[model samples]
Target: MVFIQKGNNPLLAVKAFVQGIGLLGNPKLRKFVLIPVLINFLVYGVAFALGYLYLADIIDQFIPGWLQWLRWILWPLFFISFFIAGFFTFTVLANLIAAPFYGMLSAAALALLSGESATITEAPWPKVIKAELNRAAYLGSRAIPLVILSIIPGINVLAPVLWALFGAWGMALEYLAYPLENAGILFSEQRKLIGGVRWGALSFGGLAAAGLALPLINIIVAPAAVIAATIYVREIETDNAR
Candidate 1:
């Protein structure tokens, strides 16, 4: 079935991304993706530091006259922020860490399913995997600078949209590259394939964010997002090839 329908359902798209990650292998590749993802961690760390230094006092001022009651309310809010932030920080980190392995695994799985094992054995495992990961990382990392820039005066207002779109594109790149590689397609080909079903992918990508959205489920969000992406990629390949 063509899972990437013309309709734009954000939840479905995210669900698909989570499914994609389940198809992944290679512990080493997962570790490799972590390096770039740590860059994101560092960025978030700076945000935390700044918030503590500059915003904590401002938050205290808003606590009102009921110090006892106010403390209870503000305490939860403060803790929640840390929890939510850490959750998303790591989910993105996982995607950044797992892209290369996902790419190779996607290619291998599709090739085997396509009755092309003979040729699959000749696949350039290292070159293709690394290239795909690098491209995905490049696209994913585009959001980092935007995030930093968003803190600037005028640009801070635009942060939400820019961050969301950058995030969507990053998810699209990382998720789509695997199936494209599995089918022996290049980055350009993968882009075209995803472009054809852009809305669907975006929808799924958004849904994948839900796991990262809530603090409790965030623990599973990273692997879940990867699995969803794998499923979506496989569906896209199956639909187009048929």
Candidate 2:
């Protein structure tokens, strides 16, 4: 977890950005990233298959006939929409599936952030899996509104903004789960602690959200976020200890 000095939102964001990219140097981090990468592939696979079907439905049912003539326009727009839809829609989906497996990754990242070697637990595999899925779902469920908003018309334009805003907020809490959970902080306490430097936390999240909304780079968003969130929270605690 990385925290910037007070009022240094820019550095907070920059550190997170650098930390995520800097993760490439740690071969250990690569192992953690691959599981989520596989999850992204799996989630996007289903979304891709349904991509056309969802697009046609959105244009035909949600879109007005006046816009029908603009299939070329609508096609590309909806394609982008699919990406947005993919962002919110598949994020939770991906988290639910990957969270269990990624918990150790999250924990490892947290240990790495603190300059400590990650240690394995004696806990059984099934229990660990169950705990991770539950943690991911606890956070993922909160984003249901974002998922719904993505499908709704008129207000859908606002979805991107909401995605950028709340998406950052959500990712902060969601990805920070491992470290926070390790510290025995629940969602409510997590929010309160994060609220101390709200802008900084959101800035951290907003950066990840920006990458998430983009093509190609979007796939790395989750793993990157988990790593980023670990650095972020740990930094904040480190600063406070001074």
* Runs with alpha carbons beyond 4 Å of true place in candidate 2: 1-8, 66-86, 122-159
TM-scores, all models, native as reference: 0.54, 0.75
TM-score winner among the candidates?
A: 2
* Candidate 2 C-alpha lDDT tens digits along 148-242: 77556555666666656766776665666656766666556766677767788778777777776665666777787777777777666777677
Every candidate's lDDT: 0.53, 0.66
- Angstrom error at residue 104, model 1: 5.9
Q: Give the TM-score (vs. native) of candidate 2.
A: 0.75
Q: What TM-score would you give candidate 1 relative to the actual structure?
A: 0.54
List candidate 1 segments past 4 Å from native: 1-93, 103-125, 213-216
Report residue 64 deviation for candidate 2 (angstroms): 3.7
